[model samples]
Every structure is written in structure tokens, then in C-alpha cells.
Target: MSGTIAFGLFAVVFVTSALSGVFGMAGGLILLWFLLLALPATTAIVVHGVIQLCANGSRAWFSRHYIDWRIVAFIASGGALAALGLALIDYTPNTAVVSLLIGLMPVLVWIPKAWFRFDASRPHHALSCGVVAGGLTIAAGVSGPTIDLFFIRTQMDRRQVVATKAAVQVISHSIKIVFYLHAALVLSKGQWGMVLLAIPFAILGTRSGNAILRRLTDANFRYWTRWIVTAIGVFYFLQGLWMVT
Candidate 1:
């Protein structure tokens, strides 16, 4: 990447990291879109995995007091199995398909809550979501909306929701990085350095976002988060259609 592009990406990371810090999801999807403009799909996925691993890790840590360890454990167990299964596969999905699925993810919230009544408090439900979310994150490069869906029916407050989701993403993204590395997706020294540089910005963004998050009422937060994610999902759907066409 050129110096100009690298600097631009740094700015993007800072801004998006803050967004994710507040919303718990949208930033990664937005970042992946920008990355696809500059890197091959496989390379973008690997780099995204690394960047998000750090971003979500920091978010989880910052909100560690609110994290639900039981949820994380259940999800991690299923995610580990999913990652191993994906690693054994010789084939990956085409980018268009993954993009389409991502596009449709946010809209899932519009479905009637009664239609999908998995109690997130149950370990089985969390494990099932983890398995599906793990596979989707590997294939699509972002699956935040899907993960968010699992928590919708839970009794968690906003802080707990964000913290727990961040923890689950940490596990998912870590598995993604390992699977890509196993698949021989090597980054250039410059790319690796860029990823490292992005981490601090991501951390800063998360901190700023958390500060902002503290001010929002739960109702307003949910309202804004849904719309923002929905808008991004539409963009992803259109982008996927354009790619396939």
C-alpha cells in the first residue's frame, strides 16, 4: 500500500474502532468494505481477522467487569470445533456468497422475536450460535450481526451485551487468524507492520467509544445500533450483487 493509503486506513481504523466500541459490531463490517478495495479477498480476511482480534480484545478487556464468562465459554467451545472443521476443508466459499449473507444479517432483527426463540441464557443456545457464527465469520470476514442476534433475547443490559459479544468475537477472530495462517495466507512485512500500527488506534477508538456509550440510554442505543447496522447491511448486499454481476 502507498503511504497515502496507509494513512487513510489508519484514520478509518480510528473512526471505525470508536463506532464498534459504541455499537459492538458495525465497525468491522465497514472496515472490511474498505479493505476489499485495496487487498485480495484472502489477504483482506486475514488482515481483518488480526485487526478485529485486537479491537474486540481491547473492547472486552475494557468492559471485563460486565463480560459473561459462561456465555464466552460456551461459544468458545463450539467455535473451536467449527474452526477445526473449517481448517480441514480444502475449499472456501466465493466472496459473493459470503457478502450476500452478510448483507442479509442485519435484517434478521426485523423478524418477529417469537419466531426465533432461543434463550441466550442457555448454554446450548450459545453454543449453537457460536458454531454458526464461527463458520460465518471465517467465510464472510464479519459476522457481528449474527452474533448480536443471539443476545437479543437475553436479559443482558447494554454494557453486558457489548462486553459479552466482544469476548465472543475475540475467540472467533482468533480462530479465523489461525485458520488463515494454516491455509498459508502470509502477510508482507509491511502489511504486518500496518496491522500492528492499527491496533493502538483501535484501542483508542474503543476507549473513546466506551465513553460515548456511557451516556446513551438503552432504548436510544438499541434504536441507533439497529439502523446503523441495517444501513451497512444494505450496502453489503448491493456490493455483493455488484460483484456477482
Candidate 2:
């Protein structure tokens, strides 16, 4: 990677981490898009997983008090199973397909409660969330939107939702890195260094966003999350369509 692009990536890591810290969504979607610009589809997905692992790891720790262990365990079990199945297939990501999947994912949050309900607190629902979200994470490089659908309507407050999602992503991202580790071997040592250098920024940004999260009312938090993700999804969907044409 060029020094200029490397520097830009670090900046993105910080900014998007901060964004995710606040809403616990959208940031990964944006970060994956940026990575895809500079790397191949599989390589970009691997890099994104590594970076997001850091971001979500710290976020989960920051909100550890609110994490629902039962929910995490259930979802993680499903996610692991899903990852194993995908790994056996030797899945390869396609950029346009990733964009389209991510773009369509935001629609989940808009579904009416009467039409379909998802609550992570329910064991069955949580397991289903894990399978769908884990598969999406590997196939599309980001599953924040699909994950949100399970948590958003739950009785859990914003902090609970953010913390639990972070923990889930941390686990899911680990599987993603291992699944695509070979593709990531193409990066030069210097490029890997650049990727690692983004970590501190990711941590700092997470801290900054957490500070803001403390101030948001549950109502405001959900309201903003929905709109931000929808806006991003529209952009990604358009980008995907353009790529196809």
C-alpha cells in the first residue's frame, strides 16, 4: 500500500470505531467498503475482520457490565457451526455481492413488530441470529445490520444491545480471520504493520464514542441508529448496482 493510502486507512479506523462505539452498527459496514477499495475481496474481508475484532473487542470490554452471557453463548455456538459449514465450502467473497447483501440488511430493522419479531433473549432466536449473522459476516464482510435486527426490538437497553453485539462480533470476526487467513498472506510486512498501527486509533475512537453513548437516551440511540444504517445501506446498494452494470 502507498504511504498516503496507509495513512488514510488509519484515519478511517479511528473514525469508524468511534461511530460503532456510539451506535454499535454502521461503522463496520463503512470500514469494509473502504478496505475493499484497496484490497481484493477476500483480502479485504480478512483485513476488515482483524480491524473490527479490535474495535468490537474493546467495545465489548468497555460495556462488559451490560453483556448478556447467556445470549452470547447461544449465538456464538450457532455462529461457530455456521463458520465451520462455510469454511468447508472454501467460500470466496465477491465485492458486488457483499455490497448488495449488506445494503439489503438494513431492511431488517424496519420490519414491523407484528410482521416478525426477533429478540436475542430468546434462546431459539439468539441461535438463529448467530447462524444468519455469522454466515453474513463471512459472505458479506459485515453483519452489523443483521445483528441489529435481533437486538433492536428486544427489551434490552442500548448499552445492553451494544455490549452484546460487540461480544458477538468479536467471536464472529475471529472465525472470519481464520477462514480467510490465506488470502491475507498476500499483504507485505509493511502493509501488515500499517494494519496493526491502526489498532491504537481504533481503541481511542472506541473510548471516545463510548463517552457519547453514555449521554444518549434510549430513544435517541435507536432513532439515530436506524437512520444512519439506512443511509449507508442505500449508498452501498447503489454502489453494488453500479458495479453490476
Candidate 3:
């Protein structure tokens, strides 16, 4: 690869990982975009999942004390089912379809809360939520908001909320990586360099984001996450359109 491409990938790793920690969702859509520019779409998905599993897994582990085990178990179960289904399917939708769906999610999640003043709190059904999160995650790589919306309205405290989300994501992402490997989506030894090169930047970004979050009030974090999600959704939407054209 050219020097420019390598540098660009490194930059993306740093910025997206940092953003992920502060925002509660890891940067799958963004990461996928960068990887697509460098590799085939299928290979890009594999690389993205593998890198994210390593990077975000560390972040979640560092915050393991904050994790909710029950949530993790439920989400993992569902995500595994989704992964299996996706693996079995012969034909899947194109990137544009996935991107557009991802773009719509932020608005779908926020409009009810912001305009209707709706509190979507209902009883937690782990199996049901897990299935949805897993299926969408496999299809679009942007299920964080779905999972977030479910938990945020549950009257959970800030730390527990973040922790639970992290835990669920860890399990979900881990399953994705495993399934991808089994499906032959992951790269072999030749591609390991790029993946390894991304690690330091991701680590640095995670630390920086965590430091910033420490000072923010709960209300501030909420407002920040909502706006960021909206911006990210628009990003995916526009990128999807560009990809198709």
C-alpha cells in the first residue's frame, strides 16, 4: 500500500476509537468505509470486525467492572443466532442498503425521545432484544443505538448503562469475529500487519476518550451522544449514496 493509504488508516483508527468510547458506540460504519477504500468489500468487513473486536474488546475489558453480565449473556445469545443466519445466507444486501439502514437508525431512535417526549421503558426481554441487536448488527454493523435505546430508558444509572452496553458489545463483537473467521472472511498472515498497526492508535484514542468522559456530567454525555449519533447516521447515509452512484 501507498504511504498515504497507511497514514489515512492509522488516522481513522485513532479518531474513531476515541469517538466510540465517549459516544457509547464503537465506530463500525466509519471503520468499514475506510477499509472498503483499501480492500474488497467482503475482506473489508472481515478486517473491520477483527480489528474492532481487538480494539473495543480491550476497552470493554478495561471497564469490565462496570459490565452487566446478564445483559452480555442475552445479547451474545441473540447475536450468535444472527451471525449463524447471515453465514448461511447465500445472497446478502449491498453496502448501500446496509448504509442507508444504518443512517436511519439514529433518527428512528431519537425522534420518539426528543419530540414525543416518549419514555420507551418497558420490561427487559433479553432474548428478544438480543435477537434484534444481533440480526441488525450482522446486516448493518450499526446496532449500538438499538441496544442503547433499549437500555437508556430503563432508568439505569450512567455507569451501569455504559458498562452494560460495553459488555453486550464485547460479546456481540467477539461472536462476529469468530463467525467471520469461520466463514473465511478474515485475512490470513499477510493482512495481519495492517490490523496490528491499528492497535496503538486505538489504545491511545481509547485512553483519551475515557479521560474526557470522566469530567462530563451525565446530562452532558447524553446530549453529546444524541447529537453524535445523528451526525454519524447522516454520514453513513451520504456515504451509502455516494457508494451507489
Candidate 4:
């Protein structure tokens, strides 16, 4: 990769990591959007999984005390089931499909809490979230908005929500990496180097976003998260439409 391209990738990682650190999902959505512009569908999703694995792992570690292990275990099992099903079917989303799926993700966040009572704390609900969100993550390259629907309305405060979701995403991203490993191997050494170099920036960006996260109230966090994701979804949906045309 040229120095300019390398720098651009690093910058996107940092910025998106930071965004995730705060809202816990938008950054990955944005990062995947940027990646899809430069790489093949599966390749971009794998690269995105690698970067997000770092970001979510560090974010989970930073807030380890807040993680709910029971929820994690339940959701992971569901995610695994979804992965197995997808792998067996040998599914691979095209760029336009991925973009359209991602673009539609924001709508999950907009659903009124009264419309669908999804509590991530419950075993069945969490498991369902795992299957649905996990499948979406693999297909679309990001599932934050979908995952958020389960946690945001629960009694858990913002800290617990972020930490637990980060932990969930860490596992989810790992599954994505494995699912798309073959596609990722097609990358050249130089491209892989760019991805490796971008890791530190991802971690750093998470740290920076965490710092800002402390200041936001629960209400503000939810408010901004909804609008920001909705705006991004609109743009992505349009892009997907254009691609299809």
C-alpha cells in the first residue's frame, strides 16, 4: 500500500473505533462502509472483522468488570449455531447485498420499545439475539444496531451496556473472521500489513472514545446513537441502490 492509502486506512480505523467506544456500534458500520468501497464483499467483511475484533476486545477488557458472563455464554451459543448454518449453506453476500443489509440495520434501532420487548438479560431473548444478530453480522459486516435493540431498553446502565455489547461483538467478530477466512487469504502481504498496522490505531481510537463515553448521559447516548445510525443507514441504503442500478 502507498503511504497515503495506508494513512487513510489507519485514520478510518481510529475514528471508527472511537465512535464505537462511545456509541458502541456506529464506528463499525461506518468502517465497513469505507472498506466496501475498496475491497470485495467477503474480503472487506473479513478485514472489518479483524479490525473490530481488536477494537471490541480492548473495549471489553477495559470494561471487564461490567461484563455479564451468563449473557455472553448464551448469546455465543446462538451465534455459533447461526455460523454453522451459514457455513453449511455456503453463503456469501455480494457487495450490493451487504450494503443494503447494512443500510437497513438502522431501522432496528428505531423500533419503539413497546413494539417489541427484547431483553438481553433473559436467556431466550439473548439466545435469539445471538442467532439473529450473529447471522446479520456475518451477512452485513456489522450488527450493532440490531444488538443494541436488545440491551438499550434493559435496566443495565450505559456502562454495562457498552461493556457487555463490546464483549458480545468480540465473539461475533471472531466468528466473522473464521467464516470469511478464505476470502481474507486472497489479500497480498502489503494489504495484510496495512491491516496489521491499523490494529494499534483501532485500539487507540477505542481508548479515546471511552474517554468521551464517560461524559455522556444515558439519555444523550441513546439519542445520538439513534440519529447518527439512521443518517448513516440512509446514505448506505442510497449507495446500495445506486450499486444495484
Candidate 5:
């Protein structure tokens, strides 16, 4: 990649990772956009997956006690199945289709999660959510909104929601990365260097996000998640259109 592209990727990884800390899941999707522009789709998916694995793993561990493992299992199973299928297929999603889904996901889940007050008390149908999240994450580098909706419906406490989501993503992304590695997607030296450099910034962003997280109210976090997911969905929709055009 050119120096300009390298710088762009670094900037994206750093900024988005920080955003995820504050917003719960948008950071990965934001990074996905930059990567799509900066690298090949397959390369972008794996590289972003690896970076997110590190960033979210740390977040999961930092708030280890707060995780809801049941949800993690559901999401992971779906993710694993999806990743396996992705490795075998070669279909590109219709950008317009994805864009519409992205726009609707927030409207469908966020409004309910935020306004209706769905907490952790509801039964967690982990396998169902996991399968959906896993498949989507494999097809799209960031599918946090899909999984976030599942959690939102449950309305767990802020910490539980954030920490559990991180844990779930870690498992989901880890599976995707493993599939990519086994498939032998090529990475240039420049690409590797840029990805490595971005790791530290991603870390810094997560730390800053965690600190900022302490000051947020439950309502604020919900709103932030809603806004970020909606924004990312719109972005993907537009990106798909650009690709087809």
C-alpha cells in the first residue's frame, strides 16, 4: 500500500477502536469502511478481525467479571458457522441490501432496547443470536449492531452489556481470523506494518474509552450505541452503492 493509504488505515484503526470503547460496537464497523477503501475485501476482513480481537479481548478481560457467558456461546456458535461458510463461498453482498438492513437494524432494535427497557432479566436465547451474529460478522467485517440488538432486547446493565458484547465479539472475530489464516490470504509487508502500528493506538483508544465510560449514565450509553449503529449502517449502505456503481 502507498504511504497515504497506510496513514489512512492507521488513523481509522486508532479512532474507531476508541469509538468502540465509548459506543460499545461502532468502532469495528467504522474501521471496516476504511479498510474496504484501503485494502482488498478479504484482506480487510481478516486484518480488521485480528485488530479487533486484541482490542476487544483486552476490554473483555478488563471487565471480566461482568460478562454474560451464555450470550457469548450463542453468538460464537453462529459466528463459527458463518466464518466456515464464508471461507468456502465468494459472494459479495449487495451494498444497497446491506445498507437497508443497517438502517433498519437500529430502528428495529435500538428503539426497543432503549425505550422499552429490556434488561438482563429476560431469557437469553444465545444460540439464536450467536448464529445470526456469526453469519453476519463473516459476511461483513462489523456486525455489532446485529448482536447488539439481541443484548439490547435483554437490557442488561451497562457493564454487563458492554463487557459481554466484547467477550462475544472476541470469540466471533477469533474464529473468523483463524479461518482467514487457514485460507492463506496474502498480506504485504507494508500492510503488516500498518496493522501492527495501529494496534497500539487501538489500545490507547480502548483505554480512553474505558475512562470515559465511567462517567456515562445508562441512558447515555444506550443512545450512543443507537446512534453509532445507525450511522455505520448508513455508511455501509452508501458504500455498497458506490461499489456497484
Candidate 6:
């Protein structure tokens, strides 16, 4: 990448990581879109996985006290199993199809709550959500919206939601990296350096977002998160449509 493109990647990682640290979602999807603009689809997916691993890992660590370990354990277990299965199959979807699914994901929130009455507090529900989200993550490069469904009915507060979800994503992203190891191997030294360069910015962004997250009321946080995610969804939807056309 040129200096200009590298700088742009760093800026997007910083801003989106901060957004994720505050909202518990949306940032990864936006980051993926920016990365796809700069890299091949497979390379973008692998790079996005690493950047998010750092971003969410930092967020989970910083908010360690609030993380729901039980939920994380259940989700991680299911996600890991699902991911392992996916890796064995070694299936890769068409980039346009993946983009379209990701574009449509956020709109799932609009579905009536009554249609899916399962409580996220149940261990089985968490595991099931993990399986589905994990599979989708491998295929689509971002499954934050699917994961959000598992938590929507839970009694967690804003901080708990962010912390727990970040922890769960840590597992998902790690699995993605494993599945994408071939792509990682093909990266040039400078590209590897670029990955390293993005980590600190991700950490900084997470910390900054966490600081802001502390000041928001739960209602306001949810309100803002919904709109931001919806806006991102629309952007991805258009991009995907244009690509297919």
C-alpha cells in the first residue's frame, strides 16, 4: 500500500475501534468495508479479523470487571466448534454475496421481538447464537449483528453488553485467523508491518471509546447505536448492489 492508503487504514481502524468500544458493534462492519476498498476480498477479511481481534481484545481487557465469563465461555465453545467445522470445509463465498448478507444483517433488528422469544440468559440460546454467528462470520467477514441478537433480550447493562460481546468476538476472530492462515502467509513483509502498525491505534481507539461509554446512559447508548448501525447498513447495501449490478 502507498503511504496515503496506509494512513487511511490507520485512521479508519482508530475511529471504528472507538465506535465499537462504545456501541459493542457496527465498527467491525464499517472497518471491513473500508478494508475491502483497499485490499482483495480474502486479504481484507484476514486483515479485518486481526484488527478486530486487537480492538475487541483491548476492550474486553479494559472492561474486564464487567465481562460475563459464563456467557463468553458458552458462546466461545459453540463458536469454536462451528469455526473448526468451517475451516475443515474450506469454503469461501463470492465477495458480492458476502457483502449483500452483511448489508442485510442490521435490518434483522427490525424483526419483531415476539417472533424470537428465546431468552439470552439461557446457556443453550447463547451456544446456538454462537454457532450461527460463527458460521456467518467465516462466510461474511462480519457477524456483529447476528451476535447482537443473542444479547438483545439479556438483562445486561451497557458496559456488560460491550464487555461480554467483545470477549465473545475475541474467540470468533481468532478462529477466523486460523481459517485464513493461507491468506496471511501470502502477505508481504510491509503488509505484515501494516497489521502491526494498526494494533496500537485500535487499542487507543478502544480506550477512548470506553471513556466516552462511561458517560452515556443505557437508553442513549442504545438509541445512538441503532442509528449508527442502520446508517452503516445502508452504505454497505448500496455498495453491494453496485458491485452486483
Could you give candidate 5's per-residue lDDT for residues 137-177 as a string of tens digits? 76665678777766776647778888998998898888777
> Backbone clashes in each candidate structure, one number apiece?
0, 0, 0, 0, 11, 0
lDDT of 5: 0.72
Residue pairs with colliding backbones in model 4 are none
Question: Whole-model lDDT for model 1 versus the true structure?
Answer: 0.85
Q: Output candidate 3 Cα RMSD.
A: 2.9
Worst 10 residues of 5 by lDDT: 113-122
Is candidate 3 or 4 superior in lDDT?
4
What digit string (tens of lDDT, one per residue) describes model 1 on residues 25-84? 999999988887877676788888888888899999999999999999998888887777
lDDT per residue (tens digit) for residues 1-245 in model 2? 78899889989999999999999978888899999898889999999999999999999999999999999999999889888999889877899998898889999889988988899999999999999999999999889988988998899999999999999999999988988889888999999999999988999999999999999999999999999999999999999999899
Model 6 TM: 0.96
Task: Give all candidates' CA lDDT scores.
Answer: 0.85, 0.93, 0.69, 0.93, 0.72, 0.86
lDDT of 2 at 244: 99
| Clashing residue pairs found in predicted model 3 | none
Every model's TM-score: 0.95, 0.98, 0.86, 0.98, 0.85, 0.96
Error of 2 at 40 (Å): 0.4
* Candidate 4: tens digits of C-alpha lDDT, residues 117-227: 999999999999999999999988889989999998799988899999999999999999999999988999989999999999999999999999999999999999999
